[model samples]
Every structure is written in C-alpha cells, then in structure tokens.
Target: MTPSLTEDGTLPAPAGNVIVVEESDMVDLFGVWDLVMVVSGVAWHLFTVVIFGWIVLRRHHFPPFRTRNLRLLGFMLACGILFWVCQVLTSLTTGRPNLPRAVCVLISPWLAYGLGLDLYMTILAYRLYLLYWLLVLRYPLRQSRRFYLFPILLGVPTALVLVSATASPRLVSTTHYPNPGNCVYSLMYSALCVVDVMIHIIVLLCLNYLCRHIEATYNDYRETTFGSIAFILLTIVAVNVFIWIGIGPPLYGYLFDREEYLAQFCVKLAADGLSCQGCHRRVDGSSSARLSYPPANPLHQHQYQRPTLPPGTGSYGETRPNDDNNSGQEDGRGTPGCSDSRTNGCRGGDDSLVEMAPTSRGITQQPADKNGHIEEWSLAHVAYHDDESNQLADKDYTGTSSAPHPPQHDRVIIE
Candidate 1:
C-alpha cells in the first residue's frame, strides 16, 4: 500500500494525475489567498467604520434619531463593529505561524458570540422600524419599551449567545493541513451563515407584507419616507441572502470568507445612510405639514351672528309691534302697559329683556330694564345669544327715534 500522508503533511496527487505540483507552488498559493483575504477584509471594514461613524456623529441631521428605532439601529451598528473586529482578528490568527495561541483562544469565543449577537441586533433594528411605522399609522399594537427593548433587544440575543457558547465551547480549533485547518470552526461558521440566511428570508417576508399593507392603507404610500426605507431594506436583505449563499458553505473552507464580509459591509452602509436620510426628509415634511390655529380676539366677536327670531317676536318670544307700531309706541313715550319716559329708556315690562355690551374683555350682560339687576352668563355660551342681543339693542336705540343717536348713549350700549 502507498504510504499514508501525515497529519501536517501535504496531500499527494491521485495516481491518474500527470501534473506534479511543487511545495513552493502550494506555499505561494496559500500566501496569495491569505493576503487577498486580509487586504479585502481590512478595506471593507475600514469603509464601513467610516460611514457608521459619520452617521452617528451627525445623527442630529436625521430626525428619526429622535425616535427609538434609530437608537436601536445605532446600537445595531455598534454590534456590527464589534463583530467585525472579532472576526478580522480570528481570521488573521488562523493559518498563520508564530501567533500566540492564547490570543486565538480569547478571540474565538468573542467572534462566535459576537456573530450571534450581531445577527440578532440586525433583525431587531428592522423590527423596530416596522413597529414605528405601524405606530405612526395609528395601529393598535403593543409598542412599549419594556415589551420590545428589554425582552427582544436585551434578553433573547443574550440567551442565544450563551446557549451557543455553552453547546460549542471549542468552536474553533487548530488543525494540520491535508486534514484541512480548523475544519470544525469552518463548519460552525457555516452554521452561522445558514442562520443568517434564514433570518434574511424572514426579514424579506416581513418587509413585503408591511409594504403591501402600507400601499393598501395609505394614499401617499409612494411619497412616504418609510416606504423608501422599506424598499432599501428589501434590497439589502436580498443582497445579503445572495452573499450568504455564494460564500456561506464550508465545502472547501469558504466559511466566514472575506468576500462575504465585504458584501455585508456594503449592504449595511447603504441601508444605514439611506435610513438616516429618509428620517431627515420625514422630519422636514412633518414640520411643514403642521396646522396652526389662530388665537381668539374679543374685537372680532362682532363678526359672529346669532340666529334671529320672526318679525313680530320681541325678546324671549313676547308679541311685539311692527316697525310702524313701534314708531307710534315710541311717539307715545312707550307701549300701553309701559310708563317709562322716552328719555328714560324701557323698563319693568319683563326682567328677562336683557342686552349684551361688547366690552374690551368680552360680552357683558346688562338688563334692558333700567332698574333690572345684572347677571353674568358663562363665556362659553355667550357667543350665539350675546351677539343677537347686541343687534337687538342697537335696533331699539336707533329705531326708537329719528334723531341722531347721542354719543353718551352709543358708549353705554357698546362699551
């Protein structure tokens, strides 16, 4: 039998193979691939870090930051940074010579746990956006901070990370070539990718459902900022799914690949920046749409007219004369049962015959009967009735005689 390959040794070609590859060729290949991964990973992460930093620093420019959803999104970006750092360190340490084993051990768990947490936070950020949209539409659903924040953002992800760590404490372990280096870690990483794929699918479904609901419910759906953000999120999820499928499998140590990280970084940067922009637009729109009510002015009270009674009706529905009869009555100094002098004004016919004077403060109730006592009515009910009374008092004073109304009489009637 042919000699078996050692654990750390390179594998020989198959018997039928004619080409012979040199050891130098294999070393060069591995070195080139590792360098590519490191460079690409660093560039992608640096770009993402800069974009996220800008968003956070200038969050005030985005009005949605005033809402809780943007705060959750900010937290998610923070988790993404942590995940990227741990993943980059782990990838750098692996398949490299002269690295401290202790450092690898420390980074491995963090990378695993951070991966889980980051995935959870991304889901949470989108979910919060949905909730906020529903709230703005006045949907009757539970949106308390205790309900969404502590339980979903804090409790569930922590539990998942703890359980995953406990179940797979040695998530990454060193291995020799020919046996495939760190095959177990690669498999675990692939599992994470699979989970991410599932999450993206769920998110896609939710976004589609929400978009449809919004389109059906709102007339200005296409013009809304939330609608634009929803579309962006849909695109991001689709891109994420494609990246996961392309690089997630560990068929040949492609798990946690640099290309995959770069794809994710681009998607996140676009989504976050667009979301902030949408929020800023929404704030501007709402402020411009607000309606303001004018304050009440007592001087404008004369513009309001009260309902009028029929021609023959006096104050409080008492039968009275037409204009001709009123002129005859005025010439006789008053009506038959009235004894008041013409200069003294009407009095004592009915205590309810009252008139309102439009004062600087408001309408003031004064008895039409000179000897009648004054009583106040609530301002809330004064508008309709008081305006009518003022009109009637003006007619009585002017129509009572053909002479020009005295200036003192005008002040007393309208003061």
Candidate 2:
C-alpha cells in the first residue's frame, strides 16, 4: 500500500497522474511561497512608506496635517511601521522552537489589533464624518464640532471586528504546509469587511444626495472631489474582498492560503495615501475657493460704498454692489488685504505649496468671527491677495505700483 504521508512530513500527493513528487520537494513549495509572499509584502510596505514620507516632507499638504488631523496621521504612519516590525519578529520565529513562536503569537495579535486596524477604521470614520458634515450639519470640513463623533465611529467597528474575529475558530491557525507556528490572516479581514460594507453603503447614499445639495446651496461647487472620494472608498472595500477571497485564513485547504497581515497593511497604506491626495486636490483647478458668495436671501443683500480700486485692477477683482441695496452700512469687515489690519488679512494653511490658486497665494481662510459664528457663508472661499496696485486703491491712483495691475479680462465668474 502507498504511504499516507511523505518523508519530510507533508500529505502525499495523488499517486496516479500526480507524478509522485518527493516529500521534501513538495513540502518546500509552501515554505518558498511564504518567503516570497512576505518579502513582497514587506518590500511593498517599505516602498510606500518611503514614498509617502517624502511627499509629506517635501510637498505642502492640504488641510495642512495639523491639529487633530496631524496627530491622527502621525499615529497612522507609526502603526504601519510597527506592524512590519512585529511581523518581522513573528516571522523569524517560524521553524524555531515552541517558546519563540508562542511568545510571538502572544504579542502579535494585540499589536495588530491595536495598530493594524487604525488606518482602516479611520478611513471609514472620516468618510462617515464627511457625510455628516455635508448632509446633516452643513459645516465646513475644517470647522466641525462633530469631530467628537470620530472616536465612536473609529472605535466601535474596530473593536467589534477584532472581538468577533478572535471568537471565531478561523482567526488564527496553522500556516499552510508543515509550518508549525499559528500565523493569522490580517486581523481576519473577513470579519472587518462586514462593517466596511455597511459603512460603504451609507456613504454612497450620502454622496449621491450631496451632489444635488451642492447645486442648490453653494455657488459653483463641483462634485468632482466628492465623486473621487466615493471611488476611493469603494475601491478600498472591493480590494479587501479580492485579497480575502484569494489567500484566506492561514490554512492548508486552499491551494495557496497564506498570512494576511502584511498584505492587508500594504493595501491600506496605499489607499490612505490616495485619499489624502484627493483631499488636497479639492482646492485646485477651476475651484471657486477665492470668491465670496451672495447672501442666502436675495432680499437681505448687504451693501456698502464701493471701495475704490486702481483702474488697472482686474475687472473681476472688484467686489460687486448688491442689487437694489442702499449704500453705506459702514463696512465692519474692512477690505481684505495687507493694507487693512481690521480685515481678515491673507491667512490660511501655513503648509500651502499644494494649495496655490491662480494668483499662487496658496490656500487661505477667513478670520474666525468674534461671536463664534463663521461669517464666511460663502465657503468663505479661499482668501486672495489683490494685485499690488489694487492694495494701494485707498491711496492716490498715480501712486499705483509701477508694474501696473493688468485688466483681468480673461477671469470671469457668472454672478
């Protein structure tokens, strides 16, 4: 009778057309595959990290990676780095004695549970937060008290997935082949995906509604950024399904079942980078960030004496008088620029290379109001600097800058 097992300790292949491969040779196939899987995954994580860090250091980021956002990003990157560090340790213990593998197994789950899921959950949570801002709150992303909801959004789903996955027998088991150590698929991605799908559905519905809402409320807002955000999020969930379907839990049943942590982290890192790029891109192109909006009620248009602008100042640069309104409310908000201290002087994200408008002034924000209400009802569109000559408008025309402000015939906005 043919032996049930091969010499090097793996199940024997089928006898007939299988061509009777040697036990050692066939068993080595799994070890080699694992080596390749990990090397590729680790290398991918490192490449993305280096590339991502370079972008962070060299280029100005939008939303300017500061305040709470900055802290979250810093922690996110740390998670990725530490993930691989733990992975390397766990992997080295493979094929070693029980104590080393046991020690690695004990620590690796918690490390992954704590750090590995953060970026993934944050992506979902931020998406939810964005939907809330656009739909329910109607607040600017940069200015939302709803930031408090973020912890709940992030923590609840992550903890449930971890808890559920660990409870399931499928969480961690023997690696394929004769590998003795219990290596887990990435946080058992299958469990996390249930929450992912639910959130994705809700986000898609909100975005669809937002496209219509933007048309009605804001002047000249585009849905391109919103569309891009939807696509990025959809891609995240879809890729999870693809990866999980392919190399499932660490088990021998599948032809090439393997570890999932490294693979999952690499995908998550790349997705986060794309999402960040999408956020920064919102400020560019024909975006109307610089222009102020008309009053919500046409009947209540506020007006003041038209401030003098130098003759050559771009035609579009001058503010329009409100329709059918008496002049002289005694402008509380002075003309915006360096000339007026009372005005909201040119201010915005300090890290602003990526946010330059056509004037190249970079991204800018209106000064916060004293009553704590943001008067910038216009999206407070990006604040812009008038041409050098225009800043001297209050001065004599003859004293205008020698270079002369050119007429902005090319620049036009439809009221």
Candidate 3:
C-alpha cells in the first residue's frame, strides 16, 4: 500500500527510482537482453584495451610515439580504458544497491562525460592530422601534445561534468536511483551527439574536397598507394549516420532503452577498429611507398639502351669475313704482318686476337679508333682470370707489333 499525498500537496516518492529500489529488485529489473548487451559491451572494451596494449608494448622502444598516428592511438587507448572503467562501474552500481548515493552521483557523470570527450577528441585529432598531411605535406610535429590533449582529455570534460552535476536535477538528487531524464545533463548529451554528427559531415565534405584537389593536381594520383584516409573518413561518417538515423536521438534513446547505449559502445568499437587499421597501415610504409612515377632526369630515362653494332659487323664492331670471296684474305692462321679485318691489327695464329661480343651484362668492347689505337673500356667491362691459367698469355701491345698480341690481359682497366 503506497502512501497518499499529504493535505499540503506533497506526493509520495516514486518506487521505481534507483535510490529506493533494493538490490534484489534491481537485479530482477535487469532483463536477460540488458545483461547480454552489457556483457558484450564490456567484452568489446576489454578487447580494445588488449589490442592497444599489445601495440604499445611492441612499439615502446621505438620512436613511433612521436608520430601523429601513434599519438592518436594512445589517446584512443586511454579513452577505451576510461570507457571500460565506466561500463564496469555502471554494471556494478546499477546491479548492486549497496553503493552509496553520494558515490554514484559523483562518479557516474564524470565517467560518462569523460568517455564521450575521449572519443570526440580522437576523431578530431585524426581529422586534423589528415588535413595537415594533405595540405602541408608534413606532420603537425611542432604542436605540443598539451595543445590538444589537455583541452580534450581534461578541461572540456571536467567542465561539462561539473555543469551537469550542478544544474541537472536528477544528478544532484539524493534518490537511490537518480533517473537521468529531462535534465540539463541529458540535453548536454544530446547536444554532444548532434555535434558529433555535424563534425562527421564536415569531415566527409573536407575529405571529398581534398580528394578532388589531389586528382586535379596529380595526373596519376589514383595510381598512388596513399593510405586510405578517405576510406576511413567515409566509414566513420557511415557509422555516425547510422547511429543518428537508426538510434533516433542518442540521449533520449539511451535514457529510455539501455540497448541504445550498447549501440553507442559498438559504434565506438567500430570507429576505433577502422582508425587503428588505417593508422597502422600508414605507419608501416606499406601503402604510401608504392606510388610510381617517371624519372625526373631525361638522361636517366634512357639509362639502359640496347648496344647497337655497326652495319655488316659482328660483335665488338669486328668485320665479318665474306665466305665466297677470299680476296687477299689470310687463312684462319694468319702469319705476322698480315692485315686481318677481324683483329683490326697485324696478327699471327699464335695467341690470335679474338673479337669479343658485348654481353647483356653491361659489358661493351669499344671499337678501335681511325688512328689504329684501341679504345679504353671501363672496369665494368673487364673480365678477371686466374694467373695459373695459360689460355691467353698477357703481352704488352703498347706499340705496333707485326705479330698479333693476345687480347689485353684480364687485369681490370679502370678507363
């Protein structure tokens, strides 16, 4: 039997309020669906923490912490931890009625607001980083971490929590279960969600503009393997759009249906997953390093042309003998003082000069000059031989000799 209103017109306190409900009643009110969603949200947050923890452990010794991507990742990881803590507290305080009203009222709003701010800052930071990279072609390294971190991490969230705590009727009430309905805090939460959606829309538009600019400036921009910043932004926008439409006003749904809050958690997980993957890909140099382009210098464009030989000539520009007509041509074993077209010098059968071919191995044998002097070859063209081998003995042919000397020794000639 509930108490009736007094003659003074004061009504009886509501039984459904969190402050009056017993632990047993609270447990029963939490249906199976609620428990499932809560558990899943908690598990997802734990998974996020583990993933980022592993990343930190692996990269702790490296200089990656200074990079924009890692800084963003660090912020996400911190936010995930805070969010996980909040979820765990919600599960405990909402389920166990033994918690003091003062403690719940004090901590709950701070945890919730801090979580929201963390997510907001992560998206904001990543968007700004992308803009800097695209427009300036450099990182925002000069900006101190405190420049962004303090405002997002501590200052804004603290102020919001304080404002909500002071102005919200439910949050300041002494009830065991203060309902977060029709309060300043709820309005603030709704405004935050709206702001999130708006920011995402702005980011999407900016990304489109940047993509168009890249295409207009670089003829082969599409062929480049730039990391998927546009794709990541699109994904984030889609997630926010789905939340805005499907969930229908986040704060209202979150206050009435706890499942909507779970959906928010899921959205956070999705955004973090996309960001981590995109940032990791960019940092690893896998995506950005694959852009191919033509050489800058024209000389380098023809660095590897095929070796062209003179007409009616064999390898090394040596004249090929006509088989049918042996006019004044010596036998295969030409004697000393014989003019052999193949040798381009006087030759004898012993240690005969053999014309060498230019191999595909970048080895070339220059033709003798009109003064009957052998042209110099680079060391790359010279082949080496062992001293023990007597196949072709070394002979100094500096001056004219009637007897054809063997091809210059295998000793490498620099020029």
Query: Which model scores highest in lDDT?
Result: 3
Q: Which parts of model 3 have CA positions greater than 4 angstroms off?
A: 1-27, 59-68, 84-108, 115-161, 167-415
Models ranked on TM-score: 3, 1, 2
Instruction: State the displacement of the C-alpha of residue 79, model 2, in Å, after optimal TM-score superposition.
Output: 4.7
Off by over 4 Å in 2: 1-44, 61-114, 127-136, 139-147, 164-415
Query: Which lDDT tens digits does candidate 3 get at residues 167-267?
Result: 66554443333543111224555565455545544554554445444433331134222434675788899779867776676566557754433333332
lDDT of 2 by residue, 1-415 (tens): 7567778988766544323323353222237756786789788878877876775676536543331244445566677667666766666654432332234334455465445545544553454455556556776766656676655654666566556545554654444312333355455554565555466455545544544454333311244357558879999988797787675653342234222322222223322332212222112343222222222343433321233445544222333223122122222232212222322221222211112222221212223245533332111122232332232111111111111111111111111
lDDT string for model 1 (226-260, tens) is 75589699999987987787766533332435333
lDDT winner, 1 or 3: 3
- lDDT minimum window of 10 residues, candidate 1: 406-415
Estimate the TM-score for candidate 1.
0.34
lDDT of each: 0.40, 0.41, 0.42
TM-score of each predicted structure versus truth: 0.34, 0.32, 0.34
Candidate numbers sorted by lDDT from highest down: 3, 2, 1
Report lDDT (Cα) of residue 373, candidate 2: 36
